[model samples]
Target: MTDQVMAAIDGSQFSTAVCDAAAWASLALAAPLTFLHVVDNHPQTAEADLSGNIGLGSREHLLEELASLDEKRARLAQEQGRLMLEAAKSRAIENGVAEPGIRQRNGELVETLAELEDDIRLLVIGKRGEAAHKASEHLGSNLERVVRSLHRPILVVPEAFETPRQVLIAFDGSKTTRKGVEMVAKSPLFRGISCHVVMVGAEVADMRSQLDWALMTLNDAGFEAHGEIRAGEVEESLRSYQQEHAIDLLVMGAYGHSRIRHLLVGSTTTGMLRKATVPVLLLR
Candidate 1:
């Protein structure tokens, strides 16, 4: 079976942009694309009255209004999701992807996604979700939570990217870095794109071997790849390289070392996500 590319759609305008990116990846990877819409069970509710002095009819009317509003919101959400899925499917078909699936589930976001992660090769989500405004710099709570929880690669699509021409792979010779390299080697999402494998904090002693290993792996996989080893902070080196090379997208491991180690010593993963100017593909 072809690997599945899963993308979460929240019925927001930004979601359409995410779908476009997912479709591009699905086509490139020759993978079936799955569009998932998760209806939040924890709908916003009005504050409860501590004092029961109000009349029964007033309370009944308020409850009825809330129910009606929830129903309307749910309907709107489903409609928007359906429309976007249809558009995405159409685009995928145009690009030669066959029979993409669209699914909707009503439940907690994190639970539902966790359940689906087993079969998904790639999880695509927008940088923000329904509640996020176009001007917001920080990611939405749902997207952020998923990133922290899911042990999968997530392509966080930004608002401005239409297509990726150049890719930056953050290499550190860790297990996660190997996974990221394997992903790029096998997946068509990176085909014909210029790949720059960057190693930060490189000592002069082993830099040659490390660079050679990376170059050999990528070349064996039929990718046009290059390597650069730099000394200094990982985040700073990556940012500088991005600026000089005009990198369109960044691919890296989500967290390196142990969780305890990451907590005690700050991680380059966290730093790059906060500071990167381009879209990031994070592999866990």
Candidate 2:
């Protein structure tokens, strides 16, 4: 089965952008789109706080009543989740995604993604949650956890949607970045976009050679590719280069620890995500 693009939405302002990005990815890959809204049931919420309000004699009865209440709340929550999913699906359709799938599950986001990892080709989530927005770090730690769990391309969408005509690739001669380069070259995701391959480090001959090799590979793959070398902090060099060239998307490697980091998204760091102004694409 062809993989689908999964967009995680929380019904915040970010949902619209997530849908837009997911729709773009879905169309780009000619794959189906699935909007997932997780009904996160916190452990603390399962039991009602009746101990303080009820006498000991009524405590047992209250516990039974609380159990019933919990059931009712769960039902209501699922209904609300369905509504959120419907709205998300409508947004995806309006954004040009045809017949997008809607999934409302009761579980942790990372665990849920893991369960469906085999079916998802790309994962799209907001760059920031509704409660925070500054740099990529504030996009939420949960967002990082979600990315770390999936061995697929993840599109971290910003506040709005923009067609990515140009992509700036941050390469550091790492194996992960090499994998990212290969993914971009082979995937239909970036077929018609322009790519600027950059290596940020000391202006050593080896650095230049690596950049040239990456550019050659991209060019050989039929991309309008260019190569450059920058000397400075990796993130700052990428920021300046992207700004000067007006890059629409930033494609790099993973973030996080353990096998998840190495297998997906690659050497991309949280600091880089925190500083980015454009959408970031991370491939493992």
Best by lDDT: 2
lDDT of 2 by residue, 1-284 (tens): 35899988885677788888899899999999998888766634455566786797698887777777777877887898798889888888888887899988998878998999999989999886554555435657667777767888888887787889999988988788888888888878899999999888788988988888888889889999988888788777888899999999999887545665333333336667776767899877
lDDT of 2 at 64: 77
Candidate 1: stretches off by over 4 Å: 50-52, 133-136, 256-267
What is the per-residue lDDT of model 1 for residues 155-270, given as tens digits with 9 covering 90 to 100? 88776556788888998787778778878887778888988899987567577677678778888999889889988877889889998898999998875445574241136766
Backbone clash count for every predicted candidate, in the order shown? 0, 9
Which pairs clash in the backbone of model 1?
none
lDDT of each: 0.77, 0.81
Report the error of model 2 at residue 247, Å.
1.1
Tell me the TM-score of each prediction against the true structure: 0.86, 0.87
Q: Which stretches of candidate 2 lie over 4 Å from their true place?
A: 43-54, 61-69, 130-137, 256-268
Q: Model 1 — which ten-residue stretch has the worst lDDT?
A: 257-266
lDDT, residue 179, candidate 2: 80
